[model samples]
Target chain A: MIRGKVVGRYWATKRIEHIPSGAFLEVESAGGARMVAFDVLGCGEGEDVLIVTGSTAASWLGGGKIPIDALIIGSLDETGKSKSK
Target chain B: MIRGKVVGRYWATKRIEHIPSGAFLEVESAGGARMVAFDVLGCGEGEDVLIVTGSTAASWLGGGKIPIDALIIGSLDETGKSKSK
Candidate 1:
């Protein structure tokens, strides 16, 4: 697992059938590594999130095989503090 | 698949049971991103290699579940030119 901030969203009209239903969000780790992650958690921009990579990520959509390599698993609590700023 | 150069090897004595038998190598992409990848193909340091990540990587081991995230799938030909230097 890795911690990152949701930076943006990605839209892909043409996708493989193996891809599950979800939103693709851009995540940037504190170390500046950026990646696009499949999100089922409805994360918004600037929200702190936890990401899972590799097979475990694709496993979220049941035991079926998928090409997805990254996934946003959780949105961190903001403690009532705004993250958009 | 991603292209990278094998930079070094890793030795982990204590590991989880789910881990398969293979060498762990350090790979650095041309973009300067580095990662530890499990290698079944004997790859030497400085060799240009192709890497597979996500479920595809773990699928190499008979399709069983494993926590491995990255793998060295192929070594690129050097045309008899030295890459070790």
Candidate 2:
């Protein structure tokens, strides 16, 4: 998992059929690296988010061979606090 | 896939049980971001390599849920040329 901030939304007309219906968010990690993450949590711009990468992310959509590599798993309650904790 | 150069090897005394046996190489992408990648291709230091991330990398080890995120798939024949092309 990585900590990041949602910068904006990404719009793409063409996508793979296997990709689930969701918003693609542009995120900047704590290290300043930016990437697009698939979001189902309805995160808005400027929100703090928890991101899962790699196979773990691809598996979050219920076990299928999806091309998604990054996923926004949760939105942080506060700047650095999680809702669960 | 991402292009990176193997900079060195990483050593860890302990790791997850599900992790496969292979070399953990330190790689720097073309964008200058450095990361540790699992390698089974016997890539050498300073060699340019092709990398695959996400579930695709985990699937390369025969389809199991592994913690590996980045993997070195192939070592490039030249600086900017692939052996396949």
Candidate 3:
């Protein structure tokens, strides 16, 4: 997982149905590249987060297939500690 | 999943044990970024492949937590079609 800050949010009108509502988040990679992530955790803008990419993304939600490729698995606290941990 | 070309192979002697031997691959993303992947499929250098990144990287090995964060799940054919498809 890579550490990044949530830069923005995403609202897709026509998207795959498997994704939960208000699940997309925009995060900037530590190296400055930005990508969309599925927000399994409720992360606000400017919040530091850890993103899980690849097929494990969908599997994190349990079994069955999902159309998601990235997921915000954890949010970071102010001290750079993981809030979920 | 993303499309990439296998640029090289990796052999880590002092790495995590969950990953299989001869599993590390150097893949160049379509956008030109290079990253390492776990080779579930035996992919040769110069082969086109589909990579699954993130936590699902470890999950693709079935159950049990693994240390991998990327996986080469499929090898593409010369026709630009996926060989496993």
* DockQ per model, Cα: 0.07, 0.08, 0.08
TM-score per prediction, in order, is 0.51, 0.51, 0.50
Candidate 3, position B58, lDDT:
76
Off by over 4 Å in 3: A80-85, B1-57, B60-85
lDDT of each: 0.69, 0.69, 0.64
What does candidate 3's lDDT look like per residue over B5-71, in tens digits? 8775544332223444545566766776666566767888788898876666676666443545677
Clashes (backbone N, CA, C under 3 Å), per candidate, total 0, 1, 4
The TM-score of predicted model 1 comes to 0.51
Candidate 3 to truth, TM: 0.50
Q: How many pairs in model 1 have backbone atoms within 3 A of each other, for residues 3 or more apart or on separate chains, i.e. clashes?
A: 0
Clashing pairs in 2: A54-B54
Cα misplacement distance, residue B50 of candidate 1 (Å): 0.6
Q: Taking the tens digit of each residue's C-alpha lDDT, what string does model 2 give over B1-85?
A: 8887777664433222455788766676787666557889888888889888766776787655465667888887754543332
Root-mean-square deviation of candidate 3: 10.4
The better candidate by TM-score, 2 or 3, is 2
Candidate order, TM-score descending = 2, 1, 3
